[model samples]
Target: MIWIDTLAQGILLGGLYALFAAGLSLVFGIMRLVNLAHGDFIVMAAYLILLLVTLMGLSPFVAAIIAAPVMFGIGWGLQKHLLNRTLGNDILPPLLVTFGLSIALQNALLEGFSADSQRLPTGAISTASIDLGVLTVGVLPLLTFGSAIAVIVGLNQLFYRTELGRAFRATSDDATTASLMGIRPGNIFAIATAIAMLVVTLAALYLGMRSNFDPNIGPARLIYAFQAVIIGGLGSLWGTLAGGIIIGLAQTVGAAVNPEWQILAGHVAFLIVLLVRPRGLFPRAVD
Candidate 1:
């Protein structure tokens, strides 16, 4: 029964990780460029929410709604002015650029928000729990898990049902070819970044609520997001969720046995997946 509770909690925690990963995976799938700053962007979004909530006494959810569009604009402008220039046949340029961007973001946030740790204010919901026969679960966790599923479902719909998604996939396959066909590769990337920032905003809402966050913590979140994306397989949203769940389970169960083993356990799961499936559990064939 304890195992059951742990597993359940892990799966729910997986949902949060999946939220962290989804934006990263989306951008990577569309453009082979890995944003080393992905995690920092997440932290930035959290700070955005913090600013909004503290200034206006708004709910985190309301703050997220406002921050997402702002983040989208920032992502769009960042890609348009900076990252677009870094794209080429060689992957090194984008990596270097994003690495620099990550450092810049860290310093910027530290200057703006200070190094003090912060947490989202949740009036009643954060501490509330629901009994489900076998075990009690946090309401915030359930909401987070629901949001993760909603994000994936919404993304799937956009990818499969929208014209923009078609353009996105086409550009991913062959940018020059896409350009010849009237889809602007650079523009698509900008839009992709904007969308990725939307996901970051959602992830930020949960991250700040779940634990204390400081400007320096983005890289750690990036690691977990990256592990989830890789373990589940690249370009597959559902697989990303599965990967997060695997990691969550490993970490929680490890902690159950020995408190110090939690972090190590997630990394072990990632390594195991790498060893067993080099291409990931569900790598995309289309791209």
Candidate 2:
């Protein structure tokens, strides 16, 4: 009974981690640019949510709806104007640029919102829970997990179905060749990033409502997201979800034994996965 409950809860928790990593994975898989500021962007979106809720008295869902498109534009413009310039044959330039962006974001958030931790006000929905036959689940967590699946499925559809997605894969395959084919690699990257930011906005809603977050917290989330993507193997949404579940299950089972083992367990699982499958549980053949 205990194990069953643990597995169920961990699976749900993985959904949240998947949400955190989806945007990161999307950008990385498509452009190979690791947005070091991803966590901070999540934090930024949270602040946007906070403002909307507090000032406009809107529900968190509505706030997310409003913020996602705006975040998308920010992401698109940022990539077009800034990150595209940093990209090259060598990955180091983009890494350095994103790292600097991370620092800048943290400082900017600090200046604007101070160091105080904040949470989105979600009313009673934040506190609500559902009782299953064997266990219980929080509504917010369930919703986060559901959203993660929806995002993954949606991304899969987009990747396999749309012309833009075809361009994205082609761009990911060979930017030079893609450009020669009249696929503007820079524009593709910008659009990919914009979509990623939309995912980030969704992640932010759950993140802020589920826990109190400050600007300093994004890096940690970024770490978890990185692990999940690596463990799942890059470029596979289902793999990412599996990776998150593995980490989540490890953490929860560890916590059942010792309070502090939660995070340590997840890391241990990540290390084990790396040891056994260096390329990840699921990876592209050539990529």
Candidate 3:
């Protein structure tokens, strides 16, 4: 029964991790540019939510809605002005630039918000739970899981069904050819980043509500997101969710056996997967 509960809880927790990875996956799928600052952007969004909640006295959900557009603009501008210049045949430039951006963001956040950990207040929902026949599950975790699924489904539809998505596929396949087709790769990239930042805002909402967070924690979250992305296979959204669940289950089961091995267990599982399947559990056919 205890093991069952742990497994359930772990799967729920993976939803949050999946949220963290979704934006990363989207950007990679579209642009093939890895934003090393991806997690810091999530932390930045959390702080933005905190700011709105503290000053405007709005709920976290309301704050997220307000922050989404602001984040979108920031992402668009960043891609248009900064990251766009870094894109090319060589991947190192973007990696180096985003890595520097990550450090700068961490320092900027630390200067502004300090190192103290903070969490968003959830009122009743923070502690709310429901009993399933086998076990009890937290309402917040269930909501997070549901939101992750919705985001994935929405993104899939957008990628597959929309004209913009067609543009994305075209740009991703060959930027020069996309340009010949009158699709501005720059604009497409900007839109992709903006959409990614919107997803980041959703990730921030759950992260801030779920646990205490400080600026320094972004890199750690980045590690988890990176592992999830790699374990699931790069550029595959559904696979990312599966990867998160695998890591979550590994951590929970490891902790059940020995609490100290929780984090290590996740890393071990990732390594095992990488060793067995270098391309990941589900590599995209196109990628």
Best-matching candidate per lDDT: 3
Worst 10 residues of 2 by lDDT: 278-287
How displaced is residue 235 in candidate 3, in Å? Answer: 2.2
Checking candidate 2 for backbone clashes, the offending pairs are none
**Which runs of model 2 end up more than 4 angstroms from their true locations?**
none
lDDT tens digits by residue: candidate 2, 1-287 = 88888888788889888988999999988988899899889999999988898889999899999999999999999999999999888988888888898899988999999999888888899889999888888898899888999999999999999999999999999999999999999899999999999999999999988889998998888888898999999889888988888888888888888988999999999999999999999996346
Instruction: Extract clashing residue pairs from model 1.
Output: none
User: Deviation in angstroms for 278 in model 1?
Assistant: 1.0
| Clashes per candidate (backbone, < 3 Å) | 0, 0, 0
lDDT of 3 by residue, 1-287 (tens): 99889999899988988999999999999899889999999999999999999999999999999999999999999999999999998989999999999999999999999999999978999899999988999999999999999999999999999999999999998899999999999999999999999999999999999999999989988888888899999878999999888888888889999999998999999999999988889998465
Over the full model, what C-alpha lDDT does candidate 1 score relative to the true structure?
0.93
Q: For model 1, how does the per-residue alpha-carbon lDDT over 1-287 read when each residue is reduced to its tens digit?
A: 98889999999999999999999999999988789999999999999999999999999999999998999999999998999999998988999999999999999999998999999998899899999999999999999999999999999899889999999989988899999999989899999999999999999999999989999999988999999999989999999999888888899999999999998999999999999998789887454
Candidate 1 ranges with C-alpha deviation above 4 Å: none
Q: What are the lDDT scores of the predictions, listed in order?
A: 0.93, 0.90, 0.94
TM-score of 1: 0.97
